[model samples]
Target chain A: MKSLKIFLLAGILVASCTNDPVEEQDSWPVDFDALVALNCRAIELRKARFATADSLRLDMDSIKASMNQSDFEKYQNDFETRKNALLSESNALADTIRLRMKGVMSDLGPDRKRVFNDSLQATLKREGCE
Target chain B: MKRILTLAIAALIISGCAKDDEPTVQETPTKSAAAKTYDADFMIDYFSLQCDIVRNTNGFLPTIAARGYGYLGVTAYESVVHGIPNGQSLAGQIQGMSAGSLPLPSADLKYDWALVSNKAMADMMRYMFGVNLNPDDAILIDNMEANTKAQLSAGVDADVIARSEQFGADLADAIYQVSKTDGGDESYLNPWQTPWEVPEADYCWIPTDLQLQPLSPDWMNNRSFIANIAEDTQIGAHIPYSSDPQSEFYAAAMEVYNQVNNNTPEQVTITEYWADDPFQTCTPTGHTFNILKQLLAESGATLEKTAVAFGMMGVAENDAFISCWKSKYDYMLIRPVSYIQEHIDPDFTTVIGTPPFPAFISGHSAEIGAGIKVMIDLFADAQGNYTFTDISQQQYGFTPRNFDNFYDLANECALSRFYGGIHFTMDNDKGLELGIAVGDAVVNELTWPKNIQ
Candidate 1:
């Protein structure tokens, strides 16, 4: 009975390790379409975030134009605060996208890696991300 | 009940293992019959690659690079024009090209427009820049062509694929024939040949550091993509050349001198960003092309829109340089560096090295001006703002910079030339004005198709 159990465990391991070469070449190991859908969502979010940051920058410019010398230091401090806040938000969003990118990349085999990367960049560029 | 539950869990595990053992044949995603099928992404990727090629290519003068890009741009448009139902040929509307000069796609035929564009670009880039390319770069172009062809040919009918590829190659050859006569003349084979002679004049440009001949002096006389022979292509008059301390030219030189002296960190960064330097860097036109690529991608541009964006900017920038160069040589303006060292500051060095050509109107300013004008025409808000990040130089290790709008970007590019102490304020300002005119002509004068949604 113990020998039977060991034989079953070894059989399972071999089965799990085997990957069909044709399918591996033809299709991604993970859900590629799902990843693309997730990426599109991230891009939409990023676009809005960037637009908001730009508007904030424009507002600062307006305020700076109108400010007198006495208010210059205070204006600079406020600018730094707002800028830092925007940077923090930008970093968090980028981190999320990076994680998604890594997940997608993990499934791509060596041969398909360049093609997948090229496609990903095209998608990102198309979606307005740099 | 507990024994039953244990058995059930074991059964589920066995089923999961069985599932993993199964050979699943996943199908590629389906598309509607009416949905556009061409890959616009490939066109964008290859053009960006071409920019890198042009940047890395040795002795590719600005004018020569512009001309190469112009041909590549039109080839892309012509390759896919048949696919866009509303698209019209840019021939005849452009100078030297007539209607029917290039072949049109057959109405009855089906096509993979992406393949058409891909083949056209690969062929032309190889033909135009191949001899000058190093072995590694050559491999890159070849790999892109082979990989794209393989990907696109899957599940396509053998005959249809053959016909489509043949059509792309034929169109590229026809366009290439026209390209040859535009004063380029096997320039790839002899990049530094048919050398330009610097004419003798009071202000005729002399060689600056690391420069030999005046680069592309004959480019002013090259066939323009726009502007007929009789067209008025001159800029508003430059401040007349003078060495007197009170003269306008002297004061202009002083502005450059003073700016270099008081050069802030911000000014230096802006200069480097727009400098688009490094022998491997695409000049200002490449920078603008990169922006266009990003904008089109952002808009989810169709193949037709992709072609037109490249086409318009290509025509605008190519002609702008031709017009700017004409004025550069015609004025024979001396460099600010030479003038400043002689009259104002002998020890004064420009923050960036001066280019070989005479500078009355800055090429960067003119190209950026033309580029921005077309972009504003296409995508600007009511406030005339079309914000985008420029990472065109990122591959060369420069960080991406953001702009508030097209005009703001153009203004910064103009300022960069000034901050570099290469051009006086007049060259940048008036060059901008001239570029706007050229860009306007490209948009208004040509009878091309409106962009696809």
Candidate 2:
């Protein structure tokens, strides 16, 4: 009787281990509203970052407009270096949000995924985050 | 008897666990009797991957990306041309390609065209994006090829698989050879022709970037795939240069100045949506290709239809850029930002960074115009109306924009440049005209398969 119980327990353990995590997660209800909120926050952050960069660029342009060719060239090189670094950071942020959204929507059927994406976009637009 | 029962129970438990550990095999579709029966999922997925690669690759600017797409599209079409009934190969149609240039598959052998397309696309992508392709993207290409092949090869004869892959690889090689002769080959190494003599004219383009050089100044000299398409599609002339406040040229400058000054939030959004800066986005050409991929997936297009669409659009994109560049250098018109600051408003600043190139014809305007025209022809009705949501920018954290017609989207893309204060209205208008002419030529000139419905 002891041996039988042990065998049964092993079988159950193996069976549980074999279960597909993706399918199991698919069965769980998704919090789509939370995802929309997350996406909105990301969009707002990106917009703010771009605004700051644009403002800085405008300032740099004003400063360079009055400089001689030599000074202008030096300043432009420094400005480009800074701009590239900021762009990389901005791209990294966007890539993270995209991956997260894709992960959440992975289990959804095509129709549902489209509907969810559309709804999220609508919300963003309505809230003026985009 | 008790020991026997115990052993039987143990065996049963082991068997049950073994069953759980067994892999679940997916059911393969019935062996396709003909190549036309294969769905376009493989082609669509490959093109989607190409878009990602284009976006991530270091030096795939618009001109280089357009040339890559042109070759990729031809490879795709040729890989499956034999499967489409009445389909004509592009060997004779495109420039520098002769009849019987590509190796043909056995007439009597059964070839899976999807496998052919899969292998060809994989090879061409590696070749076209050589050196610039990161390890992560290369892994993606490998995984996609393996997964697609596994699905396509099931229930098919091994001989057919071998033949298909060989033909695909050979086709890609042949196309690559053809691509090498195009003047733009390996042009990515020196995108900005440094130390180039800026034409000393009052109206010629001046550098606006740190590099102090124009982007792809020699790109206009690249060979166009379509014969005479570049020459035929060139813009007539730009608005004459004048610093006088009352001149049309100065008015054009002031228009850009005022637009940037009073740009609404919505206008700014539009500008950002279509900005498509290289190294950030996939540039203008890649954005257009992304839209095509989305539409193809939505409609459940077959490999045949998808290949033809890619082929046509790719040619259109390559030629459009060439023609646009020709006009750009020929006229060497000054960008709006330079003119506005010097003549109209010294304090003027554009909403977006001005690209370091001539601005006579907006590259975005011309490329998107050509792309949309191909899309409209392939997917639109007789009245030229097709409704679709463009989510191409969604991956970049931008909200999806909806369009009722392809023309509306093209026009919006053109207008975005103006609103951003980088292009004059005439630049956009003439750019559209040039693009539409090229698009029309691709549609009318190419002898694609009829009765695709």
Candidate 3:
């Protein structure tokens, strides 16, 4: 009975310390280094996507220049299908990165959030996203 | 015997004078002021920094960016005009800037024009974007100023350089003072004013996206750099908005939808290249300036000519946005995306993201129109057939695009808006027309000296 009473008191103390359940659930220590690494990863993903799209575009240009109109049309339709799929994939990746960014942003206090965003911008610019 | 001795002495004297003339040096021709040029590398760096700031600044609409560029360009021009012979001040010619307003540079003092430009830009940028800068930007501004000052101080007399720097600062101060009263200050860097409440009337713009915040709705309320831009320019009228599939308005929406649906790879490339969209990317205005910078560098232009070109571009673009915005808000016409989703296709999306604003005259078309016209006026007579590769987006890993002429580039920029499915055909056409007129006015109406021309 004495041990049970001690357990109850400890639970009450824990609840009192974290009275705001939503804040307790949402707040976490932001690893700024990890966040920056994530930003770089996002930029790399974008660069890859852009490069792939550019290659596909160049191939289309060459094919159009060399092929007959009928053949070009068939190829063009196929290219469009692939392009749409690529766009969807790229968008999904961007969305995932964006959500991670939001998590980082939300975890920070206002001052730290501003600092993180500024650092992130500088990093992205250096990474050629500027 | 005495006569012979005197004649012999005279002969010796004459011989001595002739020998002296043989070793005399000819004077080197003095270079004309037009030939005089200061270091322009800093201005290029300064503008690139401006692009960086524009990229980072939150909610910076294109019109606002244009306004900021106008000040930066004009300040750079006016600060260094002392070094350019026969270069006239734009103060009295441009509206609201008076002959009495400018502080004249001291006559016959050897001045470092680049130093002058550096000081003016440093001060102007610090003040112009002062309210909006984050801590990182504030530090950048300080570092940029310090580095410029350090560079200018090398191998230069302290007193003279100090005087020259002060002269530039004074000029910028005078301009900044005038700017404060121009209604720009109240709206400076404020890009997200509560969108003007749409009236309960026919053809009003309805919100399309979930966020539903229209951009820069009160932009027209900000005074134009050129007063006449607001009063004189005409966008005429757009086809009245309608839901009927056969109506001109509906037809325009259909065209946007179809083009987006049937977008080719070439069309996609054009759209993406000219989009010059958000993030730390140089906004469209900056992109035009970047191209101009490249052209100027390659043309081997003197600093005076470069300054004049940038100054004219600034005025033209600044006024173009003013005229474009006036038309946009005057109509409050709905975006094609909004209309298409409601009336044409619920499942359709644009090839590129739609900017948050009313659709009428496209800003990109207007800016390009102004840019090409001003460029032709300045350089086309010489470089009308010149071709150059645009490496502006090299950092983004895109291959450089080439243009045969400024016109070709401008036309491509205009067409890109249509391909992106953001503008109606008429918007691009009419915006270009308006921009051309504005550009012409800036060139013809301004009082550049005949000597410089």
TM-score each candidate: 0.71, 0.81, 0.71
Best-fitting candidate, scored by lDDT: 2
- Put down candidate 3 lDDT per residue, B1-453, tens digits, no spaces: 999999999999988876321311211112212324455656766776787676666544687778788888888778766666656777766766766577766555556777778889888877677677667877877788789889867887887688778988998899888778765663544565654466445476665542365666766766665657755766698887889878998999899889999999888878877886323345788888877776665555666777787788888888888888888888887778878888888777666667777778888998888888777877676455545666565333333476668778878899898888888888888888888788777788775534332
Give the alpha carbon lDDT tens digit for every residue of B90-162 in model 2: 8777787766677776665677888889999999999999887889999999999999999989988898899
As a TM-score, model 2 comes out at 0.81
* Global lDDT of each candidate: 0.70, 0.79, 0.70
Tell me, by DockQ, which candidate is best.
2
Write model 1 residue lDDT over B39-158, tens digit each, in one string.
577787777777767755765667778777778888877776666555567666666576667765554566667777778888988777846876777888889988888987888778
DockQ of 2: 0.16
How well is each residue in A29-118 modelled by candidate 2, as lDDT tens digits? Answer: 456556566667656655655665575566765676789989878876776676566566656666565455545444454455555566
Candidate 2 chain B: worst-modelled 10 consecutive residues by lDDT: B20-29
| DockQ (Cα-based) for each candidate | 0.01, 0.16, 0.01
Where model 2 places Cα greater than 4 Å from the true spot, the runs are: A1-31, A34-38, A48-56, A59-118, A125-128, B1-35, B277-279
Clashes of 1: 0
Interface root-mean-square deviation of model 2 in angstroms is 4.0
Model 3's CAPRI class is incorrect
- Model 1 TM-score, 2 decimals: 0.71
